[model samples]
Target: MTNSTWLKSADNRVKLLIFAFTILLLPFVALSFFTFPTTDDYCHTLTVNDMGYWAYQKHYWLTWSGRYIGTLISATQPLTYGSYFGYKVAPAILLLIYVHAFITFAKALSANKLPTWQTALLAFLMLFVFIAEMPSVAGYIYWYTGYYYTVADISTLYLLAYFFRHYPAITAQNIIVLSLGLILLIGMNEYTLVWLVILCGSLFFFKSIIDKKLHFKFLVLSLVALVFGVLSVTAPGNAARAESGLYPTPLKYNLLFSLKSSFTWEFHNLSKMAPALCVLTLVLIPIACILYTSRKPGEFGFFFVHPAFSLLVFAIALYLSYFPSYWSIAEPPNLRGQCVINFWTLIGWTFNVFVIIFWLLEKERIRPILSLGVLSWVVAFYFFSLYLSNFNYRSAWSDLLTGRAARYNKEMIARTELVLSTKEQQVTVPKLKNMPYTILNVTPDWDPAWASVEVNNGCAEWYFKKKFFYK
Candidate 1:
């Protein structure tokens, strides 16, 4: 086939893939409609309402977290204004934004050589892998309070896209835009701060070496990001929050624990088949196709680094994702934190695979091995495996099929109605009979009697203006 004809065929195939993935994702979006607020959602809404927006931001900065941008977003959750519909649709909205950012990054990486439809398919695949294999879809996707991490992840993608699209010729405009993006990213979450600094620092170091001259604009950008990162890590709320945790370890112990725990988590993800399948089918295949079709191999100068060095850089990035949680709290990150780690893992793995492929393409013997038939088989197997074992998709479908999500929504609504209508100062409600596996329910329950008295009562009392307990 001619090159243009092949390109047309490939674009058509990518469009089909995007459509299929979108259909598969619809159930997860549907489940979001049944989502209800829980745990920190209530506390944050109450605090924001009582304290006002600016005061709540100050309170969070001083006592809870230094995540200024994150806290700022959390304080304005739909629940704070009693918009249940807004709460229900927030995840869908965030998911759409995430997809857009991913597509932008993917297009930039491809240098716009691929069609928009092709980049979109790449985004869909990445999203599917993330939702399916991430440790906590509920915490990261459905929970409104956890959205700071989501927004941070999205911002990172956009910043990286901008960097990729405009590197080697950094303009004043680029510096200003990057500076603003870095400030927002660093303030959203410490994980993104550490990840971005390491990534940009490494790139700046390598690019300077390659060009045999210092890039002054990037140097300024890096310094700006570093200053913001320091501000975030040193926030007074970090210390206060650490002190308030139930178990506080010494700094030395926390560092050691973080090293061990981070390595263990990284090793676990590396060994998983699902992620490997995703790397091969979603990431490697498209990259190989783009490289093979390109007229000049030298256009990808960035991928010319030694594969071992690239792997080491990616390893450090992945490890640091786990470090902040352990260093601060002396425990593994919560489910929300795992989402960031998983994202880093996927990105690192994909990049490493790309480096290897780029290196292999230089060898005449290996060029023939990357055939269309082999890629087709890989794609077929990926879909088959995803259908059989993708945990997120299966869990979401189970919640919908068994009516668990509906029942959970019904129970939460009934409880809210009781809290609002009751004249008594204290109220007792029944424990939730159905909890969807696809949603995280951290609210206190009767089974754990203390949780009912402690967490459930406090937040419910403040938010509903009535004491709440579970029977």
Candidate 2:
């Protein structure tokens, strides 16, 4: 690569990264976060006895460890969707975490071989791939419980990056911190717990096979974390919880049912969601090929083989993501679970299409046919984004603009006045349900139970606990 060629590649990556940052940031533009707790947000909060560290000692190690941070910080609900758009630590932390994951995956793919910008491009492509096919992208971001799980789940990517980036310069402190991070990530949720183990184990085994010399320290950490992760899943508390009629089906029957459900769900979802999937692939496939398909620049004629290899890895990843969902009956079969699984499925589907297109571009013998196929999809995406997808975005944005949001925000303040003034156990706060959300049911209402001093209201006192609110 000449100086000019390298510079051009670098420039293209920066442009693409900026584009992705814009896309990832786009949803916040429609600020309509509801004040009232919606669906599971109410239920999850009810499980937390109080906001003390003892809340961390409760059963369900996996769910507690996964949600501990978010549940703690989220003492107050969004109050309004607009709360998340600002520079506050609460709203932007997830974006920063995602950026870190982006950087990590980029390093894995390109390392020193590609420019920094290319890494950014890869990260954006992955996010775009997931967002385009997501069952409910808004739910993953705006739903408090949903976002908590998603954040912990995404920690897998950060951990992978930590291993890849820090393995070379591992200090004692680094090892400890990284190990702790791994523990949190592995115990985040069963879905992440199961697949993350496979990811680390596969990496460990693959390194042993390919590198001929493996790091004993890395292996030890991996194995220890793996054991602890599995233990967390099967903790005595979880077993007791299960026995208490949380899951109706027996263990053996649940396993078989899970596998069957996993397959049936994937195929059914893929068929239903094909149009959006096709649009994302059409736009992203060629771009990934053009930017840098093979990690090694000198690998000639491996185009067809490499895409297949990429496809296989993503396919396995997608398949394994569903394992935790099937293993137990605790997992929801709605958009929340689908959103998590769809993240990986969409990634696999994108690579499967990208590599095939990339291979055709390499073969002049069948260039026109492949080129036409790519062109057709690209055109399809163009129409889909402009006509179909934009309607969805606009509709979502418009829904939030209703007086209900401003009304709810005011009602919440007024209700707080009644409670704070009277110091009452219960107050009939003014009605404040959110406007309809298209992708997520952010259309929330207060659970009447939450009004109790023992229940949600105490947990919610954190919202007012802040100095900013009191001052």
Candidate 3:
């Protein structure tokens, strides 16, 4: 190829990267625009309405099931939601992570020293894969409830890539950064930190296996991961026992069900074909390289396939972690099944993301059709996931929201100038009673048996109690 031709190809690759970045942001705007104000959103709105900016700080008082960071944000910031916005720091964090993932994927493609066309293909595929199977976007981005998971997962991936790229230069200073990253992951949710540990271990294992000289580093990584994993899983220092009225055990059990639930959801997506294509690319690429090098035996060896092999190793690690049905030993499923599946899922997702890149970066004649097909499948999968999410919300919405009559009270509070003098009122509507949420105690009556109360602003306040509020 001539110098000018090479220059044009490089320019095209750069343009393609820019295009991918633009595409990534479009979904964020699109999803945020259409979602209705669900109950959790409304409840958050009510909190803002009642406490004003202080509601943000009060979020810190609320313990996150997995991570403590949200509480930290709420603690530091007087959580503010006006007529137009609720606490959006979580979503903003997600945006940053997605952007970072795209950039990293693109740079890796560019650096792999592949042909120009191959580079463009790789970049496009990465973004495509991310949107397809990552139900995080559908669940959290749409409802704003699951955004933290997206933020934490993408952030952990980005951080892992950064650490890996600079492994030799990692310093004591980097340890602090890694610590903060762990805290943020845990804050996003405990599962995230657990996943982070698994991923670090996976990466270390990959290096040791692939490099032929990194056994010590791999051992060290495994130990660090083991220690971090233990600390993360056990660190819920102040968890309270569930009240008799709640079914916490069933919910914990549901985490086990995640093995089935996640795979079922994933397989249902049309875009899952992308992973199959990735496996094909991984297989074909080595075959092609073998043929290319067979023409000149001195130019290459089986090790020319190291990147592909590395990918396979990583892919296996991911499969074991995320693909729920892969763990056959656990009967009917156990916490062991869900114990740290997110790690594998996230890593598996990352591998898929890169496979999409490889598809795009291949210099074959069918590139355009492959790219379009992959992109179309991903978008279709995203919409399907959204449809399923809405279906779930619809199924539960009436029971969880409309049945409560809490929206009416929330709307009333929205219009009132009532200084929430005291968070001192909580009403427990009888379970299975089918009664509308009582507007009782707007006039300040406290019957301890009939209510639970805390003093927030000053005036006695009453609210219904539930396992989870609507969002």
Give the per-residue lDDT of model 3 (tens digit) for 1-471: 584465356676577556655654543542332223322334444455566655544443343232355433332221223332333234444555565674564444233345544544444444444444343333444334344555555676566655644454556666666656665665555445445566567656666666676755445555665665564344443232122222234434345565665455434442444553454344334333323433333222222323455466544444334432322222222222232333345345445444444443443423322233345446446544543454222322332345333443244344232323323343322212232211112213432112232322222122232221111
TM-score winner: 1
- List residue ranges in candidate 3 displaced over 4 A: 1-24, 30-38, 41-64, 73-83, 86-97, 108-121, 136-138, 168-176, 202-225, 236-471
lDDT of 1 by residue, 43-143 (tens): 88888888899999999899878898989888877887778887689888887788788888888777787666666766676676777777778878888
Model 1 misplacement above 4 A: 1-15, 115-117, 248-252, 273-286, 292-298, 362-365, 368-370, 442-457
Q: Model 2: residues >4 Å from true position, as ranges?
A: 1-20, 23-51, 59-89, 96-100, 112-122, 162-180, 206-222, 245-253, 272-279, 282-317, 330-334, 347-392, 402-404, 418-430, 436-471
lDDT of 2: 0.53
- Comparing 1 with 2 on TM-score, the higher-scoring candidate is 1
Instruction: lDDT for model 3, please.
Output: 0.42
- Candidate 2 per-residue lDDT, tens place, 212-291, comes to 88956667667866886767766665555445554665642376676776667667777765666666565555454543
Cα lDDT for residue 392, candidate 3: 25
Ranking by lDDT: 1, 2, 3
